[model samples]
Target chain A: QQQVKQSPQSLIVQKGGISIINCAYENTAFDYFPWYQQFPGKGPALLIAIRPDVSEKKEGRFTISFNKSAKQFSLHIMDSQPGDSATYFCAGWADSWGKLQFGAGTQVVVTP
Target chain B: DVKVTQSSRYLVKRTGEKVFLECVQDMDHENMFWYRQDPGLGLRLIYFSYDVKMKEKGDIPEGYSVSREKKERFSLILESASTNQTSMYLCASSLWAGGGGYEQYFGPGTRLTVT
Candidate 1:
């Protein structure tokens, strides 16, 4: 029940297209959700995050659509570019939680 | 920025050898974590420390141990390195109450290869 399941192990998108990745969790207690981006050899970086309090949150070209009742969340990348090609991970945690549970990553490739 | 640094970027070892991966966070955060990343299995937490001299086991803690002597430093130890233990090890840190929310800052990761 602590696991966060992510789908589409790999994705291919064209430049200037929209890229979407989905993740769902079994634990409804999870309130904090965040997405991370990792380059070829670097560590994953915090890109965007959303809480159950809001339905959606957007930052620049990256947006996170969160559904509280369904216990699911998604990351949408607008204007996908080659540089955006990387591995993305979704994670979740409950309120006053100690550890964060991560999902199986999605390898996104944006072709020019 | 929360700076999390690992001791090595790449490490090669033989089976039965002991290995130690060190991690340090500059921000003096209360929580530190160690994880292993594989192809299909994203990141699995091995251990974490909430404060100096305090540690907790995570999902996959078998064949691994950790040490947190100081607040800013956390170490993952392999008692006897095995071929299957070869993986990309990551270290992260975050505060109890962080900006926006609890966000982890990861290190560049240490790629360990046990032959």
Candidate 2:
């Protein structure tokens, strides 16, 4: 069974708009939720991460709003730019040294 | 910088051929992971090794095997390549975060095409 689910499969936003991607999980053991960004022909890289202790965490233009009670988290990119057009993935893990279950992904497109 | 390097950027092989994808890390981390990424399917774990000669099966380990003979190197082997195995493979490594959760650093990736 898939531990984490994400949506929508694809997104489109204009420059300077907000791009959002949401993910939900059922496993309460997962304590770390991280978002990754991937450019074409490249491996995914860490974008932003949030621990369950905090409801929200923001880094630069990237923000992660997490609702532990809801078992859901969303990534928001403010002032989205064309350079941000890429695939985004959300993952959950209990032990950082162990395996991480990942959501399928969301393809974001930012048009200028 | 924590650097994970994959042996190949792109490779093409025929069905039924044996394929090996090698990954090396420079940070002397204790954890290494292998994952394959497909469009609309995200990253799926193939296998992982926490220490030399110690390995574990991930979600999708049916057709793949892994070896970690040295601390800094991990290898993913496709015993017999199939078209379905054609995907981008990524390798990652991370150190233990004092029992706390930590993120992993990934390699550029190997785009393997099994014809």
Candidate 3:
């Protein structure tokens, strides 16, 4: 069973619009949440991350909104660009387990 | 900069043949992981090693085995290549932060096709 669930298997957005991907987890033990971006033929790279201690964390155009009460987190891309078109994965990690549990992933296509 | 490199970008093998996928990291990370990427299924971990000569099974480790003889190198082995095993293999390395999750750096990945 997938520990973390992601929504909208795929989505298309305009270059100047916003792109949002949501993920939910059932494990309260999960304390670290990170988002990874992967381009075609390349490996996934860390984009942004947030801990449950904070409600939100922003880095440039990417922001992570975490809801500890709801066990949900989302990535929002502001002013989406064609360069941002890639597959994004959400993952949760707990120090006790020392491993990351990843979501199914969401493919975002930003069309110019 | 942290760099992880795989032995091959693409490979093809026949049924019943043995296959080996190699990964090497330059950052001297303490942990290494192997994962397979399938459409819609995402990245499923096959195995991981926290140190040399130490390994742990992951979510999907039925058809695969891993070896980490050296600190910077990890290898995934398929004893008998099967068509169903065809997928993209990714290797990642991360530092061991005592009480928290650290970032993982990934290699380019190797796409394998078993015919």
- The top-ranked prediction according to lDDT is 3
Question: What is the Cα-based lDDT of residue B57 in candidate 2?
Answer: 95
Once model 2 is optimally superposed onto the true structure by TM-score, how far is the C-alpha of residue B61 displaced, in angstroms?
A: 0.4
Better of 2 and 3 by DockQ: 3
Please give, for residues A32-75, the per-residue lDDT of candidate 3 as tens digits: 99999999999999999999999999999999999999999999
lDDT of each: 0.92, 0.93, 0.95
TM-score of each: 0.96, 0.96, 0.99
Query: What is the DockQ for all candidates, taken in turn?
Result: 0.65, 0.77, 0.84
Q: Supply the TM-score for candidate 3.
A: 0.99
Per-residue lDDT over B87-106 for candidate 3, one digit per residue giving the tens place of the 0 to 100 score? 99999999999978689999
How do the candidates score on chain B by TM-score? 0.96, 0.97, 0.98
**CA RMSD per model (angstroms):** 1.6, 1.3, 0.6
The lDDT, on a scale of 0 to 1, for candidate 1 is 0.92
- By summed lDDT, which 10 consecutive residues of candidate 3 chain A come out lowest? A94-103
Where is model 1 chain A poorest over a 10-residue stretch in terms of lDDT? A92-101
Residue B87, candidate 2: how far off, in angstroms?
1.0
Pairs that collide, model 2: none
